[model samples]
Target chain A: MGTIENILIIGGGGMVGQKLAHALAREPLTPGTTSALTLMDLGFPPGSPAGARQITADVSDPAPLRAALAERPAVIFHFAAIVSGQAEADFDLGWAVNHMAFWHFLEAVRQEHLASGGSYCPRVVFTSSIAVFGGPYPEVIDDGFPPAPLTSYGAQKAACELMLADFSRKGFLDGIAIRLPTICVRPGKPNKAASGFFSGIIREPLNGQEAVLPVGTDVRHWHASPASAVGFLRHAARLDTAPLGQRRALNLPGVSCTVEEQIEALRAVAGNDVVALIKPQPDPVIESIVAGWPRNFAPERALALGFRADADFRAIIESYIREDLAPEQAQRLRLR
Target chain B: MGTIENILIIGGGGMVGQKLAHALAREPLTPGTTSALTLMDLGFPPGSPAGARQITADVSDPAPLRAALAERPAVIFHFAAIVSGQAEADFDLGWAVNHMAFWHFLEAVRQEHLASGGSYCPRVVFTSSIAVFGGPYPEVIDDGFPPAPLTSYGAQKAACELMLADFSRKGFLDGIAIRLPTICVRPGKPNKAASGFFSGIIREPLNGQEAVLPVGTDVRHWHASPASAVGFLRHAARLDTAPLGQRRALNLPGVSCTVEEQIEALRAVAGNDVVALIKPQPDPVIESIVAGWPRNFAPERALALGFRADADFRAIIESYIREDLAPEQAQRLRLR
Candidate 1:
């Protein structure tokens, strides 16, 4: 509780983890000194450590992670998940990584807490997704919405959320579930994720490459910046949970926009030349996946707790340019 | 399908089962026909049933139920549970009866469907409860509300609902979850159910005996009559599930009233002479349990589907008199 000196990030090599580790290192925490941290991912941080210990370990097989947890970290951020496309393609792997591993992680925490005479329950902040809300929606969603997940991935996350709530209520672990919107302007190379295209059309085009917009421009979605997502995790780990009472899982706030609006924002920030770098190539698979997702949510609970998102879609684009793009990247207008 | 000529009722000697059996017999679903009906309970039925098949079988041990189900029942009413109070008190029994047996039942149905090649997945009407909804609510609950069950019993029921939804979606079982409100005006000796006093106060006093009114009279509750509950099960079994689509569970509507209102209705029915039989006894354990229950629900979906309940408390009392009590017993009321 005091400064979160010794921290462990389970599944810490992912996109979200990398940002959160950097954020925690830069923040001024309590206890008057920056705390020591351990970042354990399936892969090590690319360069050197950023003021913390780095370990590469597989979480599904817990022998190594259990050893790491023995260090008795003050907080644990669990972000490990098989992306929706991969999980839907491979059922066994989905069960292993997303479903079964979650139970293993929880049992590990339970044992650690009991061993400490109920005095050492670390704060666990789990990253769930908006995919947990399936269709038959009211156009705008709420956190109280029942999770009638259409895919195996959503079902597993919903099940894990249930376990977290149960274990926390039983006083075994201090748990929080933050249902994150799809992170917009994700600064990375295009991946095979079904949701990857949400960022790809924007990110790839911003870098002067024509990216295919697979779904129609009318499709609306809920989004958060990678920075905002990392902030959400930090706040979830540190927020006063007593006010939440029994409502452990909260829907994190996000920006709701149609794809056309996203394109407009990109045009405003990077010029019409950058926007023209996008091409429409419809894919039914992507359209089907996107159609099932929630477009908007009234996250009153999380907003009341001071969680926030980008002021506008334009700001989201500007943040990407300021953070991800090189200074010398040229567009048609700039070349003239 | 096909007139539901053969029916099977599991746990058919418990309070709910006995009432259902009496209702079914009185109605004579297929009069003077050789349509075999089976009722399986852990205990034997009260009277010798030469015509109806009564088997003493534990549902958790699938062998007996499997054998009974092989008779090709067209419909199954599963009303078995170690009630909330008992289930919460004993963890092992709770898992055995409430959680584990449900999976066994579903698996059995899956096998039945596989063997019959989609010819005979019996319509399963499970009596789920308002216990499924936990706190952090508005004035009225809705069907789409996320189930944040606060107790082990509620969790088990929610798990069953999820499993049932999965099975129905997979085409393994024709399933529906009817979340009944607490069945009020229960006509039996008081037992250990935490919600029992809700019924005991009015029911026992109606029979000219003192009944302990634990907790305050102002506490509000949602209620349905046993007869209406039976009708819910029967209708739910036969309803068109196509509109239900992927969401197989239905939250049945009920009458929400304050304890004082309930007493007032009882006074109207049996006059102040019978009301004097009620004694106020404050009990904290009962109060705590009652506090967590949902007091009202806006069952818009259920209402649109044509389900009905008593128009008022007076109608509910009258239904009990005309249906549950004998003529002589009704005459003893003297139309006060």
Candidate 2:
């Protein structure tokens, strides 16, 4: 038997992290090798993927994270961050969790690498966001577009990407920052993120609940299914980084559609009742924030690197239904 | 008279800082307004500009920086950094000084702002660099081009820009990061930066000393004179940041020229005897590093905001001869 690869998911309790953990549990990161999984977070939600060892700890405190790094995991998926709205509202906490903690984590990894006689470089997959690009954006943000983050959350993420790329360049650890699109059909309840309604408009309606669409139906955004996000993480871990060549941050592929198109897709999947659940309530605050977001991308580098996106907006909704729809929600949908 | 504007130059011992300090001593950042200047660095060279208070301290330690912030300087010109070559060689020192210190400094400013009942918002001018970009670049890198720093130094500078922009966005401080082109014809002995030869090729020959031309004459690079660098810092400090909006980082203008052009310009300014002093001795290490540097920029925003560049490469060379040529070197050139 081949050696078992130890894996660490830093924000493993979050939606994407849990999905990644479950995916890894089902199949090893590498096809032929067995792997052990460890998840770290402030706390895991109930019924988080079982069997994976959990380390309940705040990223704001570095002590616990340092202990986690001691194990020398082969692949470390770093997803810990304060979401956009919270980061914007609470600058200190955002900088603490999103920027400072990541700096400490990288340093800890470097310490581990140095202690191991320079042979313990791990694959670090950091989930950066499209928020890194501010408005006055191109019609299609190409690979060459600079990151002008409009929000503190974005600035923090962009800062992390810079560190990751530099550390990787210096050979401390192999790192790839995948600038993820808004994850649509995000499972569970809506959070305080200004972009949360992108998922809420879909998730809430599918669960037989009313959803608030704060911006206009004309509002367009880039999106990927939660499954694609997991796939991007895995691909980043296994892929050869040679092609990335210094520019380690990548804009991932996603479906670009207006809220109107999204509504049509929801109607196509779950009928008029589900579509009817979406209420258009124009919010000036969300409108201003959304205005600064990127509507589409020409993620040529990511696509060339074999990262795939959902086929279309319809396919995106279908993936959510297939992968995340709860039994009660499914029953409720059938009754409608 | 208006209230005296308190100014703090964090890297006041360095070349650009000293130039800025001298300029501030001569006049004021805002014409007709009295201003007080304080310089901070590890140490200052002999004969630094008079009339300004000097604080000798390493930026790696936050305690001293916090103490400096206690004074609540109204305008902070942050230039403290481990230069590119040193930063690349010493990873720990580079990140500590270049990235972490800046974070602590920003936080310290925030603390002061909070302590002052939210009234202390200082104008922060950060000296960033063109190194924030890497190769595979466009003919003229526009304002939209993202920073993909090929060196640890570049990454550190880019990270600082992010933090500064974020802090400014949150109204914690009014910040602007000006990405200066390579400062050419640097006075004193040549340093270890890969681009040192850019200045050495010009400065040494003018001083009647032999200098090596490591790369081919076809190599083009962006450059600004030391005087222009000070100008940029001062302009950034006084410029109304409203036009900057959320994107606080600006790409300053610079002279772009090839080595062949630089040599021709030197011949025009001096004579064949001086130009002949430049010998061709290829160094692969420097050649490789130089190849990744940006060659030109279309800094539209900065130009629109009234930040000017040297008229041409000839003007850049003249600025150095006028401001930095030592008396002994001038006598040597006269003898030649």
Candidate 3:
């Protein structure tokens, strides 16, 4: 190995973080480089990927974050945040964890840079979200569209993006904020996120369970699979940020489709029996929340910068089935 | 008099704040309602407006802000911030005052709202600036343009706008962040702001003093007068925010003109001798900084909402002469 690259993943216990951790364990961040990984979060799932040191700590407190910065990791992936639902429900917690913690973390990074005579700038990849965009949107949200976030979660994310860009501009760190679309077919039980049903309708049925469709079938949204999310994160880590100029935040490419199209893709992959498991239950609360979401995007910048999305919505379903479905679930699909 | 409506102006010592205070002392926020004004800042300028109580306090500490919020002022004008040049020079102080202090203030407001059983939402009028915008802009930046700030000051303002909007959405406060264009023909000595020369080239020359022009006359910029800034603040305090919806921040209208046009306006009003004091001595530092600023804007929302601007560039200069020129300065202009 040419060199040992130390990588840190905050929120490493989260789904996307674990997937990224596993991918990094399987391959080096760069050719001829051996990577050392450290994962930090409030807690980790059972049997998280091996070969990475895990630290259970709350980011809301700056002590642990400052301690972690002492090691001066070569690459830092900051994915730690309260989910949209929790953030909306608990305003104080959302601002403290999602926004304040990030600010403290950035300030710590700046201290490290200054202590090292400005040579310790690390590559920081932050996971911003599509919640950053609100409604009255253009048919296709282009790269130039402003972030008018309607939710506290989105407002926090957008604030982080601004700070990250400023810190990067001041040469404190090399940073990129990728606004990930809703990760579809999330691998796990349903959570309380208002957008959770987008994944529930697809993931639950594939596991031979009933799922609730909260909004109308015509309700459209932007989505990417967990696998594509990993790809975007890795690509962001290695991206030459020179092309991004001062606009460090990006609207990443994603598959945009309606709930009906998502159901059709699910049916095409798993057959009519699995599709029958989905039941319509109109949820006005979720409907109003989802209405503020962006249904489509023209993420020209990310595409041109070589960030790829799923081939199609059908491909999204296949990726989930291949990667997240349990052996028993896979067997049932095969037998069908 | 009708019921006394308590109003608080942060940064009350500053030019625009004093202008606003003077205006408020002269007239009530709403007819048929008596207005009681309170001004808070680190220090006040000599001869501040009468009939308003003054408090000396540092916003960097949350105690003073909390104490202020305890009174539950009906209208709050948050205009306090570190100027761009100073903010760019001192990163820590910039984030501390411009961003973090505002965060704490908002939190305090939320606390007051909760304490009052959700009945104490104040009308918060924040003085955001065109500095929130950066270059690579459209020919005419519309209301929908994203805030991609190239400076730490701009980024800080943008972050504050996000917090203000989110808080307003949660009904903790009824806030409006008006992105004020660069205030021109400022009636005072020039400060360290990179955009200072935009005012200096006019203010100094009109006062029978030589002014250094750092950039080319061809460099265009968007501007409003100090009088208009006060107007924007008062209008924001009285306007119905329901029409603003979720996007509580607005790009207020302004006059767009180049330095040459500004000089010509001066020559038209006073003769060539007064305009002759503007010396063309290009400074690259200010030039580079000003280059990233927005040149023009199409603030349709603000215009539609009845937020007006100076009729033209000549009108901007004329307003300064009419409102801010000292008797001695007026005498020199009359003789010219």
Candidate 4:
């Protein structure tokens, strides 16, 4: 009876949030205590899984957090924020949603603990990004590298990371933040993030549409499938974090490959037809933004601590195909 | 009349603030346009410098900041924070003064810019500390090391550092945060900071009174004179921060030495009799706090950028004697 029973997903309408929700529903956390899920977002996601009491709430407001913590949920997955492009474009909204909301949520949790006479320390699994790193960096960035985020999105995430560590150290909450690599073959419509093209190029071509290749194919970057990303969240939720000490954020492991290598891997899986779908179009705006993004990371700590990703880009593509796309859609995709 | 007509020192009541105020008074910023100084704190410091218009108010409240910025100060020296020991003692005040207050201050500056048709970007020089580092083991921490602050004070500083970088990147201010080393042989009577012994042990013994050495003589740490600290602020106020790119904070250079090394330096400068006045009595509270403090840092950035410190521990002691001790006290210290 003493386990994670009441779970809350703050950004349950988002892609990662929905996946995390499904993963949790598939395998109940700690088996005995996890019985109910409270999924909250700006709006209820279409066709969410059963047993979750879905809530449409703007978490940027303190009310949602106040209500969510009133349930005294055993675990909280905080993944809400405007994306990178939006954050940089709209400064005040970025500060409100990305930084202020997150800080207030933590403070609310701390206040709840104080209200409880120092008893509650909920496990908080946060989704951080490689955006926390900016370039003119070493070829292989590591755990020790201080965050020098060049974008508003990266800066917001990095600031949150620091607060997470502090909140945990002070014993207000048990938190673990995983800095994710780019999620390739993302199953969604294209959005404004500079990294959106990494997925769009692959996702569009597979669906029999032409894809724009904005940066040069020689550009090297890091990637993981959506499945691997959800796996990291799951692992982070349950793993013993005392080994993490005061450094609360771990750089999740991923497959490092150039765009040429990615296209080659796609070719190996789907042959020449898929390769032909990509149109070479250099975009300086996207290219400049992507240029400052971190190329690769040596995520030794996350790797040693048992978090794993797709071994190669081929495996990543395969995982996407197996998880996404209908049988008819898949057959058509293979031939197109 | 054209360059920097007015300036603001946010923490002018503090030790470094007072020193920086005096330093500025000695040399006009931009040679002609620096005409006035607005010194603000919780209470006015004793005998503020000439031409400094004094203020007494809580900076955690936005009213003082609004009033301060009404002067349209061209240079803003942000050095007002609750010190480490006090921050740890009061959690809410720490977050409010050390983190939230600093954040609000930045936002206020940003708002002022937005109100000015997007042109006002004041030079913001923040006084950060090596307390941002908490150690397991790294004999020489360098520019690349991520902060893992073990104390609430350090955490607050680290978080503020991240925000400083973000604010500067977003073009809100031309911000530069320099992590100052522990100032050795501080002039004033001792306070409650864990680092107080670093100054007290030397200052008291030189004043012909026995000083308590709370930890082992082998405990190593970094040091700079109060003068050098003020010099860092002066230099940082005018340094070309464009070269810093996305990373806004720097590890200011300092002399690194052990307590035993300090004792040897004291002996060299003031002879064996002065060194003998240090009495060893371990205080676990201070010892444990000091244990987590960083021993050394390789600050290649500040050194290359023309910041400097006392040449050696002997020089640090001599500087303290020259600046801090009275003429009679100095003669008595030399004889003793």
Evaluated on CA atoms against the true complex, candidate 2 attains a DockQ of 0.87
**Ranking of models by TM-score:** 3, 2, 4, 1
lDDT of 2 by residue, A101-183 (tens): 99999999999999999999999999999999988887999988888899999999999999999999999999999999999
Model 4 CA deviation exceeding 4 Å by range: A1-4, A32-34, A334-336, B1-4, B32-34, B271-273, B334-336
Model 1, A150-208: lDDT tens per residue? 77677668767776776677677889999998888887776557888879878888777
lDDT at position B45, candidate 4:
53
**In model 4, how well does chain A match by TM-score?**
0.96
Clash pairs (backbone) in predicted model 2 = A146-B146
* Per-prediction TM-score to the true structure, in the order listed: 0.83, 0.96, 0.98, 0.96
Local accuracy of candidate 4 as per-residue lDDT tens digits, A183-284: 887886887788888887777777778999999998888899989988998889889999998889999999989999989988988778888899989999
Q: Which candidate leads the pack in DockQ?
A: 3
- In candidate 2, stretches whose alpha carbon ends up further than 4 angstroms from where it belongs are B1-3
- Which 10 residues in a row give candidate 4 chain B its minimum summed lDDT? B26-35
The runs of at least 3 residues in candidate 3 whose Cα sits more than 4 Å from the true structure, single-residue gaps closed, are none
Record all residue pairs in model 3 with backbone atoms less than 3 Å apart, i.e. clashing.
none
Please list all clashing residue pairs in model 1, or write none if there are none. Answer: none
Point to the candidate with the largest lDDT. Answer: 3
